[model samples]
Target chain A: MYVILVYDIGEKRVGKMLKHCRKYLNWIQNSVFEGEITEVKLKEMVGEAKRIMREDEDSLIIFKSRDERWLDKQVIGQERMSTDHFL
Target chain B: MYVILVYDIGEKRVGKMLKHCRKYLNWIQNSVFEGEITEVKLKEMVGEAKRIMREDEDSLIIFKSRDERWLDKQVIGQERMSTDHFL
Candidate 1:
């Protein structure tokens, strides 16, 4: 599936979360990552994310689609990071 | 259409952006919003966003789908905001 993951992590653990997410997806902007992965990989990534997050304060949300073609994306103003290489 | 909008705005202008987005979509997390809206409303929102953003430093991204059913959302850890009312 193709996914866009956005996270709001406590200041202390955010860097670790960023590093871990980078291993599985494209870092598109501040605290935002997206890319394609299998169901197994997605499950594995979520497990790791749970470890880095604080249940009381940190949160991660994933928006999933069966494929990229099912979604349309538009960017306005400056793009801090690009996921274009994946194309 | 259903759209998921995420933004990276300069600290000074972020509050305004947040307020503006809330008028059109459900706040799902920090800097993240999702909900259904007309093509015209989306365009209007984008236009207002451009006015508040500095083209060199801020960026707004919108991920659109034909309908909410076409996408799946998963939340991990604490959800900063609830978007259940719309559902």
Candidate 2:
């Protein structure tokens, strides 16, 4: 299965979050990640993200798509040029 | 039907995009918007969005779910606290 992970955080510790997410998935866009992951891995990572994020001040949304073909994506321009900006 | 609208852009004309999107959907988060729209309305709005955006420097993604019940969304924290930030 393919999963798209996007996160919203209250703190400015996006560096840590980005690093943590890179271990399991590709850094596709700002706070957005996607890759093939098993159901078991999805559950495990979701649990880990929940644990790592602030319950009241952070949110992690995982859009699980059974197939990537159903999603059409297009990338253009210098959208994410600054790594120093928010992740 | 329910539609999820997300966009990536190179220029800094987010204020116009935000205003345009707000006219048709609810601004849920930065560069993210969602609302219940009919199939006809979805198509119309998508065409408008495409025409309104820069073809080479902007990209728009629409996730259409016939039923919103299928999506599991959890929102927490002060993630989108700033309006001056990127849309």
Candidate 3:
């Protein structure tokens, strides 16, 4: 499944946030991260990422199908952002 | 980024498990499921999927990067299941 993690973060700290997520999530592919990803595991990743962030930092992790209907609608409604930013 | 959801389920009910995940997660394209997947949203999906299953059914949603080092090592140790099952 195509899991797109959209983290809204500061331009200065986005790099650090991505790196932390990559390490905690063990991400090595485009935007993909993996482990024994149960609900608990997922929560742990988010918590760890949150802990690593500054007090004002925030992030969003979006998971969806490549052909997700709602996402397609979102792309139509919102300005389409390049996937390369995270990739 | 490839997020693979490995659902451990009954042989009889695997099809339904996949379908439910597809609907709730909005999966399309090679095991990809997309939604505004927050920790809460992920929990909701898991709960919904669990509720839909029968007493004999079980499932595990394993999300990982396609190049997850741990998963690659797992593939070396464990049997590599075909991706087609979820795709």
TM-score of 1: 0.92
Note each model's CA RMSD in angstroms.
4.1, 4.9, 16.4
DockQ of each: 0.83, 0.31, 0.02
lDDT of 3 by residue, A1-87 (tens): 233443445577667767766644444332334322444555676676666655443434445343222121111011212232444
* DockQ (0 to 1) for model 1: 0.83
Each candidate's lDDT (Cα)? 0.87, 0.64, 0.44
Which lDDT tens digits does candidate 2 get at residues B20-63? 77777776666767678887887777676666778676766666
TM-score to native of every candidate shown? 0.92, 0.67, 0.29
Best-matching candidate per TM-score: 1
Candidate 1, residue B75: how far the Cα is off, in Å: 0.6
A1-85 in candidate 2: lDDT tens per residue? 7666667665666667777777677665666676788888877776667667776767566666566665445443334432334
Give the per-residue Cα lDDT of candidate 2 at A81: 36
lDDT of 1 by residue, A1-87 (tens): 999999999899988888899889988778788899999999999998998899788889999999999999898876655544331
Q: What lDDT score goes with residue B82 in model 2? A: 29
TM-score of chain A, cand. 1: 0.89
Steric clashes per prediction: 0, 1, 12
Lowest lDDT block of 10, candidate 1 chain A: A78-87
Candidate 2 pairs with clashing backbones: B31-B87
- Identify the candidate with maximal DockQ: 1
